[model samples]
Target chain A: MDIAIIFDNIGIYLEGLQTTAWLVSLSLLLGLVLAIPLAVLRTAKSYAVQAPIRAYIYFFRGTPLLVQMFIVYYGFGQFEVIKTSFVWPLFREAWFCALFTFTLNTGAYTTEILRGAIEATPHGEIEAAKAAGMSRLLMLRRIVLPSAFRRALPQYSNEIIFMLHGSSLASVITLVDITGAARIINSRFYSPYEAFLTAAVFYMTLTFMIVFLVKQLEKRWFAHLQPQKTS
Target chain B: MINLHGYGPSILEGTFLTIAVSLAALALSMLLGILGALGKLSGSLSLRLAAQTYTTIIRGIPDLVLMLLVFFGGQVFINQVAPLLGYEDYIDINPFIAGVSTIGFIFGAYMTETFRGAILAVPRGQIEAAYAYGMRRDQMFRRILMPQMIRHAIPGFGNNWLVLVKTTALVSIIGLDDMVRKASLAAGATRLPFTFYLVVAFNYLVITSISVYLLRWLETRYSAGVIRA
Candidate 1:
């Protein structure tokens, strides 16, 4: 409706978008890095190796991300010992707290997705790789990890979208992401519908882009499932 | 320092409100889910488009943003329209109603997708067979489609329920005295943030674990006829 006002505030919105992108991208990368080894430990034979990973995943997955963020940001701030610790500088900023929580939360879910994919890898494929005289590490690097990555991509894409949406919660902890920017604008202008709708559009566009990219990746990976073309 | 002095009544009161809000939201979400699913699956183009748009937009926006938007915007909208209807005094929307409706609307979008998928997974031939047997549309839906759909929908519905339950915590940001809000208050008052939040987390885990077990029981019961002995 207020086209001129929206265009006038484009710079502010773009800054918000940049922050949103940074939050999602950094969290996702860190989460994936943490998830891979955890997934391996989860499906490993030793109970001692697997137990902690299982507990970590369960605790993070079970609790709401908001509570986790608050505990990390506000709860930790309450303790005198934590304030004086070396980690105090890191925990002092809202951004670090948000990234920490997002990393843990996404790590838990990603580990589960990766574990399922790894377990779903067919036994015959692994056996065949071994028969070809490939080393255990080589087999895992080549055959197992590739297949598991492909298998996990679809669900992992959903996780990415979810994490993107969840990052908005970081706005609560004083991070000026898109949602926070929208809140600021709404409070200033008393036109919440306009501000919120604009913010929603930015989010929707990002989601649509992710969906498109995921579909392209799926088609590339599952090319064998496609009907063959007659020359 | 963490002693429960006057906090006993306040925490109890907050728990009661939390349960009340969750149940009311769940009921409203179910109603919206059914209607949205039907609309999406219907033959009419406009209805399908409308339902699709509703689910997409709601699902894209975070619940926190949506909740805030609805609370603040709804208050202003109500005030604007109230004077025209001859209501003089400013009518403030109850925080409970605002929280419930906002969460319900968001979850309803998710439930729409779940229900739609389940409905589509129902074998079409069975519905055709029922029609051939001179069964009316409603009768066919009641006898053939509904039971099978519910069986398929239970798992997804369970997931939605868990997520919806956790989302109730977001209402605390809007000043609703739900469990999380009460916990924050107690933490501030007693300077025992870790203890109070841990208690809050434990309460959630207890509620969630129990509901999950109950849901599994319902799933097994509904699916009993399908499983071969």
Candidate 2:
């Protein structure tokens, strides 16, 4: 139980932490940017618009993120056309591949989460906005999206934690994330418990912080939804 | 470009293995889930705390880390312990057992939450009515609790099963030679990573599609008497 090994390679762990942070935040940011529109379109009255979005979400949510990562990292390399294309440079890097996979995976899940919240938005709220002569776009911007986002906040927070954990797969593709760092330490020093358990501690700490932040956001944003105090 | 070139059969075999591993893990997790839900609901303070800690820690950590820890670290622990019991060799933890148990243990936390919520969802009035009928514990559980709980639980259970089936792909990381791993082996041999991975992904799609329908039917069947909003 040489506890010094973890502290010995503190810089490597920090680099891994940076990679993990970069992957999770970028992917989550891109995922939300894409998911909001897809979710809105997913609830459209027309079948033509809804069907393709549904398929995209289903395909992504149905498969494992690891397999999706492989498809981007290794599978894309199999094609000569892709290698010759301008995107070849992006596909060649493991970080880009990982970011692409996580972004799409998280997007698929967030679409569903947001879609559920949007559909559950009180009909009376939308009705009152319509009766007030608000335009469709204005009503969506003011009444629908805001409330839907608040409702989706709790579940979406869990999704962020999940993305944080799933970013560990970046290690598999040689991206040197936190889990990747642990793998390096394990192979070098023959200490799985210390290597992986230390990584687990970092991850658990991140999870707690994310949960706390989400809770606070909910507290401030959701005050009106709470029961009112009587005088 | 689209051909498996003799690796097709092996990939199919791996697909079967993947399904077997998922089912085995599902069984183990459900057993652990029931016990965990019971522990959480138990009157004993220690039992509730133990169950609470287990769920929190397991849920907090990533599945990959736990898989690696249980497989590699567990192997090291067993190797150290076995020599004291007169075993002379390094114990190679079977990846199949490692994968199933790791996924089982990880998903058991999820199932615990699902089961606990389901158990709580069963209205108290129904239980009181069962008691008023002078039914025994087993009779009450079978007739009243289990059926109603199943109704509340099916959707969550279905979601977990879908995720569990996908999680089977992670078994390949531990060298379980499941479908995803078989695809990898084929890709390595033929230099056609795209086709092999696409095949496995399609296989997953088919499995999940069928599962969605079957689980939907189960939900409908169980909700025969359930009045819906």
Model 2 agreement with the true structure over A121-214: per-residue lDDT tens digits: 9989999999999998999999999999999998999899999989988888998998999999989898999999999998999999999998
Q: Give the per-residue lDDT digits (tens) of candidate 2, residues B1-229.
A: 5578999899999999999999999999999898899899989999999999999999788899999999889988899999999999877999999999999998898999999999999999999999999999889989999989998899999999999999899899999989999999999999999889999999999999999999999999999987879
Per-prediction tally of clashes: 0, 0
Interface RMSD of 1: 1.1
Clash number for candidate 1: 0
* Residue ranges of candidate 2 with Cα displaced over 4 Å: A229-231, B129-136
Q: Which predicted model would earn the best lDDT?
A: 2
Q: What lDDT does model 2 reach?
A: 0.93
Compared with the true structure, the alpha-carbon lDDT of candidate 1 equals 0.88
Residue lDDT tens for model 1, B1-229: 5566467677767777777788888988988999999999999999999999999898778888889889888988899999999999998888898999999999999999999999999999988999999999999989999998999999999999988988888888889999889988987998777667776776777878888999999999998868576
Residue pairs with backbone atoms closer than 3 Å in model 2 (clashes): none
What is candidate 1's CA lDDT for residue B64?
Answer: 85
Error of 1 at A68 (Å): 0.7
